[model samples]
Target: MALRIRNHIPGLTAALTILSLAAVFAAVLGVIPQSSLPRAPEPLIELIPHINAIISTIAVMTILLGVRFIRHGSVRRHRAMMLTSVGLFIMFLILYLYKVILKGPAEFLGPDVIYQYIYMPTLAVHILLAIVCIPLLYYVALIALSRPIEAIYESRHKIVGRVAASLWLISFVLGNVVYVMLYVVY
Candidate 1:
């Protein structure tokens, strides 16, 4: 059954994306009871934001390297880099969800004008772009994995990949900015 589903790349990608999004939404909404979740030590909870920020920074660099490799026609290297980026992103998400579940959302401590006009809008856009990138990244990844390199060029991979990469990069950058604003500046 797993093998059959694996052969059906589109279906598998869709399933994975749906499941990932559902998990993220559930975490954000605190749908899971706090009593059911294990508590992280205060020290570990305190370290989560810094760790996630570093993961985001590494993901951005990995993505940039993946783009460079693909542009230079290094398909294997590009694939490795992209997979690394995805793994790093997953790590970031897990840590973030854990922190949010344990500590709840961070309160922005900046002034009203900055919070309302600058931070809020930037955070909103970052979240929106991250949401938009999920299915797109999955689709492109499925295409690359299920088909031959040559076949990917014939599909919508390039177009979708470009859009996904751009959005993912911007989202990560904006996330780092949000982290700084919440943790450092404010």
Candidate 2:
């Protein structure tokens, strides 16, 4: 079973990535009716963005630590950190989906000039990176989880992991910036 899964990493990654992105889009697009979703309490709804911000921050830290661990040849620590980051990412996504499904996306209350010239562009790039990171992250993660450390180095894991980590870090940073713009600066 493990061998079968290991051999189909690419197909599995593509399928999982597509399904994950589709679910996210469905929530964002309101294809899942807000009426059908149970409402989170007002306080939780309001707090989710803030909670996501903290999660993103922690995820950023873990990704950095994971990279540092790998660079230092500490495979176990790196794996732990990377898996923790993935867990944080899942938690963040669930909260974000809940908020979006219940109340929709947060409105920008910042000035029109900043919103147009800075915030929008930043957000666009952040979102694009996030979408791109999904497949790359999934690919690298699947490879890592399926293979031993020695075997991973012989595969595309290093190349893909580097790209995934870089973009993942950038995405988390930009997400935090977006949160500040929406919740704090405004």
> Which candidate gets the maximum lDDT versus the true structure?
2
Segments in model 2 whose C-alpha atoms lie over 4 Å from true places: none
Count of clashes, each model: 0, 0
After superposition on all C-alphas, the RMSD of every candidate to the true structure, in Å, is 1.8, 0.9
Least accurate 10 contiguous residues by lDDT in model 1: 1-10
RMSD of 2: 0.9
> lDDT (0-100) at residue 77 of candidate 2?
99
Tens digit per residue, CA lDDT, model 1, 1-186: 434544686787788889999988888788856777888789989999999999999999999999999999999999999999999999999899888776778999989999999999999999999999999999888887777677788888899999999999999999999999999999
Q: What is the TM-score of candidate 1?
A: 0.93
Candidate 2's error at 92, in angstroms?
A: 0.5
Which candidate number would show the highest TM-score if scored against the true structure? 2
